[model samples]
Target: MRAEVGIKDAKVMGIGPAGEHMVHAAMLCNDYNHSASHSGGAIFGSKKLKAIVVHGTKRPPLHDKAALIEAGLRWRKTLQQYSVSDRYGVGHARHLEALPNNNMQSSLIADHNRGFDHNRVTQRPCFQCARLCPWDVEIGEGEFKGKIGHFNAGAEWLDTFWNLGVKGNATLYLAERINDLGIECGHFAFGAGVLFEAYEKGLVKAEDCDGLRLEWGNVEAIDKLLEMTARREGKWGNLIADGPLEVAEAIGGDAVKWVVHTKRGVPAMHDWRPHFSNMLREIVASGGMKPQGGGAANPPPDLKYREKWGPLDRDDPKGWPQSNVIAEQYRQFVGLMGGCWFAQMHLKPDGLNSVVDSFNATTGWNFTLDEAMLAGHRSAILQSVFATQRGWIADHDWQQVGQRFIDPVPDGKFKGFTIAKWLPEMVREYYQLSGRHEKTGRPFMNTLVQLGLEEFKEWAQLD
Candidate 1:
């Protein structure tokens, strides 16, 4: 709400200072986007408006259908009135298609600056409490005029929505989160593990790490190491942001090939090399130098390659194809609601359709399930084109996460199994089906324009 309102002292959970600063008009978190620790919205503020907090007792209803049927609609409303953010509940997306940023979009210019703040807020919300509240709006006195910006912290590794249910171990945390059955963030652990090994090998001594020991299997030590790395605390810390690949080259170690990163030196997930197709894509899509083009986080329900082998069992084969269809549909569902993808997973197709019905009842959009999928696919394709311009390819071996399955499972229930060998053919088939280039690994230009991304033709100079 503060973001939409430009309230300097007002803080919304899960936002960075960069987001807080770029506000003209903001939306407060409604029942759908508000969480126990966070709120999403557009904000506005005035010259003298230090803060504006609209508190309420609305809680999300419980997910138990039997309980809902027993409690009745009237009872659910009453329960919601007193709901706190901590309670477990699922809320559907409410399409607020009338808002700015294509119903809901962040300032691209601000996002880059807000990277640190995003990380900070994710790691610890306390950072916001300290500095988020106080800001000087340069707008002269007016009802809704001010240059607003908040003191947002950086991104936290655990701030990702999917990490909510996983165990937290610093050394293995990256691996767990990246390989989350419900989510996928591409391969990041290969580099993290390598860094840990480097530390153990005395490559990064105590002095390089600012007195912190980078021992293997020590969560505390790894956590401290990450903080230092994120903060750039010591000499090595300052250079650490260069990422594992660069670090390996600079330090003169045999770690570059194993560093497995996309363009920006961010390491590929643990399974980079073994999945050569993915690695190839990672290398190509990442500007052939940087390594950030790989997909960010994907929801658990979005895991498409469940058959390749992992700890989780497939819920139903019907869902395999249905799941993709649903996933595509859900994206459109979020666009209508003006919600983030991280928050959209809680609303499956059926649940989302219910919200659309509510919206039509209130505002009369008459949004249909088919319409939702079209919107999502259109938007997603645009994003895919952007990835292609940045160098996505079908043959990149380092980009995919399935490469990790080549090695036998070390200690899990699926131990000693190597699915890596089977991943390429499967992923390649997926690529072919998805309409990627056969040799260059880029998406077909027609696909880009088809997805409402005509701008890419001009951007990439493609005819």
Candidate 2:
């Protein structure tokens, strides 16, 4: 498609065999390694559409080109000053003892530095990104020797590393191989971890896995399983393709205990147990287990949330209301502007004022911070309504809460803390603050009317 469309002029987005087979964990990938990973790609594949290509001759007309350029430079400068760079790629998380190990059983890995070396890794930033976040790594020795692969720093790299490294003890080469195959790494890891747990309990036998040993860190078996899943070749592969939750249900018995996911799929790499705001965001987000915009990580320093909530404690339930309010606005702003999350991280110190200025400068709209925040709220409400229309109402949102996220961290900095006890209250606070039904998670009639979405009220049953 690129060849026919001319490489410079064309941009293409498509899914792989996993999507073609309607695998639940499938994702869409474009030219610059950007992926709509959270958006299920199987929906497109189910329509029999292979790919979409765009060749645009015209650029969008900016309200003030000089102002936009100046704003971009300022934003870039702020990001460069504040951005966190990882030296050892994903392995840096291990050094901080922050990497999720053994399917989130713990956060620390004692010997995570075994295979990763600074010399073997090179930083690779995305297009137009000020933060040099991603890495191209080479494995000097191991089963995956001589193989070079690309991985994003922090969560993206950590997910693959923890899933394969901490859980299976697999080499970094295997993780890179999976990335190349276009499989969703987090989902794959969750599925693999479930199978490993079942194997340990004798629930999954050798014949069930097509004569392959179902053991942690069995690199060759994992590779074969990934292939089987993509091709839908065997019983195990076919089952895993459906996703970890479905696979657990099919296996029955105690296997469900090993599965960790919400309604949509596996949670993103971050563990919510040690962070109350993160836990609330995970539970109340429109898409199941999808990362919501505002949380403890991107708190507006200028905001009085600190004065109101006192201190930020991982277990404190007091922070949820303020956190939810900020997150909703922040996420909305990022989505509307087509800006990355890291940009939000840097501009957060100035609160929404910086974001408002950028938006106004780009479009020549004189928007106050409150108006800009309402735009985000409007978008969030629409998304919630859409999810409700699809039968994923508030009642159904908490399906995986007890099974996956409620458990206390057995060890680490957050030992003995459980988000389960406080989840209901936090969720209620979120719904109330967002002007949605606390129990149903549906947008209130007033909320729709306020957002000028009065026409959608009846369709959403809010009328």
Candidate 3:
């Protein structure tokens, strides 16, 4: 296909056999290792669509080509100057002490530093990425010795390292192999952890996994499971491909306690116990379990809230209203513009005027900050409505607090902090600020009307 279509002209979005077989954890892989890893791939496979190939020669109509080029150059300069390490930091779970280990069984790893040596690793950025956030680790010893593998050493890296490294007790090579598998890391971790737990509890046996010992960090077994999941080969693979929530229900007997996920797939790798807002954002937003937006601490100097609310507190419910507003705006802006979040976060202190300017220059939409925000908010509402139509009720929108979060942080700066206590307050504040019903998480009639989404009011059944 690449030869016939020409690689430069053809843009392909494809799925593996797991997606072809409608695995719930199936993901769409595109060029540059970019994936839509939110269960949409299964739908495409179910429709018997192999791949979506785009070959376009015509340039998109730009309102002002010169202005757009100037904006691009400005934005690129901002990104190039930004220090990714200083902003988000590096190291695979080394900095975070409360990194969830062994499926949230413990928060601490005795020697997480030993999991992956920084000396043997090199920075590998994504396509045209200035940050170079991902890591390419060279394994010096073990089964995958001398193999170079890509690792996302950001917020998402902790889950992969924690699950395969600390919990599975696997080597860095195993983590690299998992990354190569192209499965959602969170789902893979949860599935592997649950199966291991089930085996430990005598709920499942070696025979169940085709005589593969379901032991922690068993490379052969984990590797086999990954293959089986992608190929949808056996009963175990079939069950696991369905994701942790379904697997738990299938296994029954106290398995639910081990699984961590919301109604939609596994949430991102962050343990939200320390930050109450993380939980609130995930629950209220319609994008499934992904983090909604950037953090509130160190507000961009130009953020209007700096003048009104002063310094923000992540844990304080009073500050969450403005925080949620800022988060929603940023989330919406990124979604609409298809820009990188890291760039937005790093450049935020300059405010979102740049985003608005770039967007206006490209699309010829004379939008002010408020208008741009409304556009973003409208997108969120549309997504929320789509989710609602797909049977995502209001009650199920919030994070399902499990035993992992229920168990207080044993030791940390925020020791004994419980997400359950502050969740409701934060959620309420988020709804009030975002103009959604506090209980239902639906866009209010007034909100719809205000956002120029009055046409969708009836379909959304807004009151």
Candidate 4:
């Protein structure tokens, strides 16, 4: 598409053949690696659109270019210090041993990354972004020899093994393949894991699986299934093509029990039976967008509202609500000035203040921490309002969570613990702290007025 348009640097975002068919887990891929949700692709397909290409030649005016540069320098320099200048790359802090395998039957796996490199030279930094997270790599001697893949997340290549019950270069190769095909990898991996578990448990036979063995780590079978999903081929393939919930339902007989999802989308694998704050993030997010709840667990020391929030307890929520609210507010505030969430997670608590200084310097709008936090809370409430209007009662929706996650961790560091015990209270706390109703999570009429979002009063049912 870029070649035809005569713009070599044209940014292209579009669907693949499967997405064009409007398959259930269809997704949009931009450039080489960046991707978005299933419905995003389905929407493009629904309108017979294949891709949107843009080539920007004009630079937008900045409030303070020099100040922004200085902020950028602080962002980079501080990250360099915090990273130990040595711990920057894919899977740097990853615990490959803790990867969930075989549909959460076990939370441990032998390291199977297959010579995956994490050298800074392999780093694929974004356009003037502070974090040196993403990576680009070339395969030298494998089934995928000579192929180079552009992967976005620091965990991009690794998540394949995390999601699929597989190992090694095949997982990396699979990531590139599906990325090219433009189907969301996490959704595809979840569907594959469910089928693998079902096959292991005899819920489905090879005959029923369209003649392919659905055993765990069967890369060939996994590849074939992905092909069928993209094209919606055969019974199992067509079923998977439909989407996670749909495919699990088609498999029937406890297959759905193996799924761990929210709002119909299967987020990337994290057996959060152990990580309470992480689970809280998944449960409370309006659209299941992974709400960066991990922010609460390792909050910046200098979070403006730190004095008000309590400490985080990994296995409990007594202090979770307030801490998470501050983290969420800070996250939204940082995002407004175009900051990276993942990068901040690694910073010293004091390093976060740099982001604030950067924001104020760039905008010449020196928003005190309190003023910015107010805006952040408003942004968050806006999401709650949207979810509330969708009939998403906070507590009720949690009951619909997949059993795989709600069940206690069978093994691993968080062994035998489940966030389920405190989830309802946690959700309620999250709502109350965010200025929503104590139980319903909807913004109160006056709360809306305080946030300058009174336009949502009627929609929030607080009119």
Candidate 5:
């Protein structure tokens, strides 16, 4: 469509999943992949036009949607006012507010939403399982005896194993055991759990484990892995700590490919590939974290809608579809703010659009959808500059829509659903709507220059 629309030259940019896709698609189209590093922006021409991509921070207050709305902000306006605080956290707010020359932090905060306080236990749901089971878990007996210590499953010896077989839900029981051990469960952080299960079954041993016991749901094993992870200890620990992808690569096994992650190293924890619809695009749009809820996905019991349309279609709020729309808008928001999404999720869906109010209050600008989209365009261009400078670009080196990625949901309830078969259409549709080249999957040169990429325009118009 970009070619059809007479958009001949432009420096294109993609960030997060969008950026990842751009890199892949550009490689496919042009047969190269060269993006800038995470820091510097790329310069395309003698004019020195730049494109930079800085993800929002992972922090609080700005992360909470309710607070953003309550504070009365639109997406762009909130980004402008709380740029640093939004991206980093409320803690960074002080740096932004300190004095005259400190606006750099403020600018960063504006590029992203504030992060959330994940350490605050009250903010999270109780993770404890209801039924009690026992394991011969070692506790600090003296100070923490029976105080709900890690792995309280007592030494009934084989009883736990017996129940596991009878219960037949090795996954469930294993999860419970790991949780009991106080392990942090993030995207596939339970890699240790799977390993522990294998170890108990004698499929793996201390020798196989690099001298550490891969005990069955053993808390000590978890502790060891955690410690190893912190220090990047040993070859095995170092590989696993980075993620299953690197682990698989180092181990020279198919383990990483089968571990279930996106093209990048991120684990597919939300189990997205199978869900039918453009929903998974949200995760694709996010670097890897499924914006709908990274760890595991759950249905929204109750969804409250804003009176008017902001970004997402508020009328239909389900899992996949609603999530896709929200994720796309979220991509736009975070990219423009150069902030992280960890904090963006904290803000309610409407919290961003309310930035209009915040803008009026702070900068005296009445922002509109057109203005917001333009900001999005500029943000995307900046991100492109960043990728180009980082040498993350190569002709046709973009992430391919893996048949497995776009096809069959490999590992969960929605196993048979195919994402690849349907997502291409969605991608094309997205491109069309955005006024981009359908074949190249890159925005036009005019669009780039419009978004402030003159140098990009010159290089893009090569020949």
Candidate 6:
């Protein structure tokens, strides 16, 4: 891609065989390792679009370059206080706590830890960013002899194949293959496992799976399933290609019980059973799969202007609804800044005050922290309103928190803790905080008016 662009500096963002075949959960990759995800690859392939190469040679106009740099430094300084940033070059921890193992069925990190412990990893920071988290790995031998990438991050690992019961360096092969094929890793991770469980319970047959015995940590069988899904080859491949929830529905009965998801979108990758606020965020907004922010001492949105109000106790389900409302506000606000929200999330200065300062400096505009938050709030409401139009306005529709997600953790630190009991009240409080009717999940007209979205009144109004 680099050589074909001639003298122009081209950044190629394209799909692979998965997107070309229009696999249901296909994702796009930018410049090789940088993931440009959100299940958009199939959309690109459907339109016969392959890759988007951006060749630019213009400098962005900045209102106050000096101030922007200063603000960035301040944000970085705060980010430096975070211990994880110090391990930037060390790559993702082989085993991080609370990563949700075996499709959220257990919390134990799989015992299959092998491969890549000896592979050298180096910091491959994105352009102009603090808290460098991206790592580059080049395989020297084995099945992944020529692979070049790292398997150490949430989106890369969790959303890819980590949560599906893989906990070893064998994750490298799955990571490389998923990107190579361009299918959604989460889709394969969740769908493959549930189907395996289905086979175990006799829900799926050997004939359906190309005669391969489905078993846990069967990398070869999993790999074949991935290939089949990407190519939509054979009956089982086409069946599971729609992802876990759809596959469960297709298989019917006990199959759906094993699938973990919210709104049929799986998760941003986290076991949210113990974290009610995180789950609430997804109920209101589509992929509120990210965990909460800041210390309990600071609370979220700790900008000088807002007061602390949230699920102060991480384990307790109380106050999560309120936290999610604010979380949605902050999350949507981050989205407005364009991708890279992951970088800005922890630096909220409390959040937004300094970042808003930097944004204003770059655009030469007068934007405030409140305005930034308001914009974020507006984005969440827009998604909520759109969801309502699609008959997703009901609390149950949003609360599709599958049995696997709400079911008690069979083992781990959160043993016996389940969101099942608290979910109803938590969802009710979320409605109150978001200013929506309890029965129908529609946001009130006044709520729309508050967000300056009175135009969506009819749509938000439910019969």
Highest-lDDT candidate: 4
What's model 5's overall lDDT? 0.34
Clashes of 1: 70
RMSD of 3: 3.5
Candidate 4 lDDT over 1-463, as tens digits, reads 9899998989998899777877766778877456664347877888999999999889866678788778667666666422322323225225323556676677654565654543222665667555655556676556766667677654533554555667666666777778777677656766677777778888888788888988777888888888888888888777666656776788788888887666676655554456666667766762344244444554566653546444556655677777677777777777666676666643365466667767877667887777777877877777677777877666654766777867887876667887778767777877777777766667778788898887887865363
RMSD to the true structure for each prediction, in A, is 15.2, 3.1, 3.5, 3.2, 17.8, 3.4
lDDT of 2: 0.65
TM-score of each: 0.48, 0.89, 0.86, 0.89, 0.48, 0.88
How would you order the candidates by lDDT, starting with the best?
Answer: 4, 2, 6, 3, 5, 1
lDDT of 3 by residue, 1-463 (tens): 5676667658888877667777776777665545665547678788998788888779788999898777666666555333333322323344444566667666655565442443365665776756565555565554455777554434454465466444322445555554455466677777767777888889987777777887765667777888888777787787778777777777788888777766646666655556655655655643353226534654455456443553666556567555656676666766778776656643344446666678889899898766766777777677776766666655664545345544576565667776566656666666667777766667788888888888777654455
Runs with alpha carbons beyond 4 Å of true place in candidate 5: 1-206, 267-269, 274-279, 282-331, 334-352, 388-407, 410-415, 423-441, 458-463
Better of 1 and 4 by lDDT: 4
Candidate no. 6 TM-score = 0.88
Whole-model lDDT per candidate: 0.34, 0.65, 0.63, 0.67, 0.34, 0.65
The TM-score that candidate 3 achieves is 0.86
lDDT of 6 by residue, 104-197 (tens): 6676544434455545566666676665656666654566665676533454454345565554545666777777788766567777767777
Q: Residue 167 lDDT in model 2? A: 33
Model 5: per-residue Cα lDDT over 6-72, one tens digit each:
4443333322211221211111011011122121111121123323223334443334445545544
Q: What is the clash count of model 2?
A: 2
Q: What is the lDDT of candidate 4?
A: 0.67
Please give the ranking of all candidate structures by TM-score, highest first, separated by commas: 2, 4, 6, 3, 1, 5
Give stretches of model 2 more than 4 Å off.
80-97, 164-171, 286-291, 297-299, 302-310, 346-348, 459-463
Worst window of 10 by summed lDDT in candidate 3: 81-90
Model 6 misplaced stretches (Cα beyond 4 Å) = 1-8, 80-96, 110-115, 139-146, 150-152, 155-164, 285-298, 345-351
Total backbone collisions for each predicted model: 70, 2, 0, 2, 79, 2
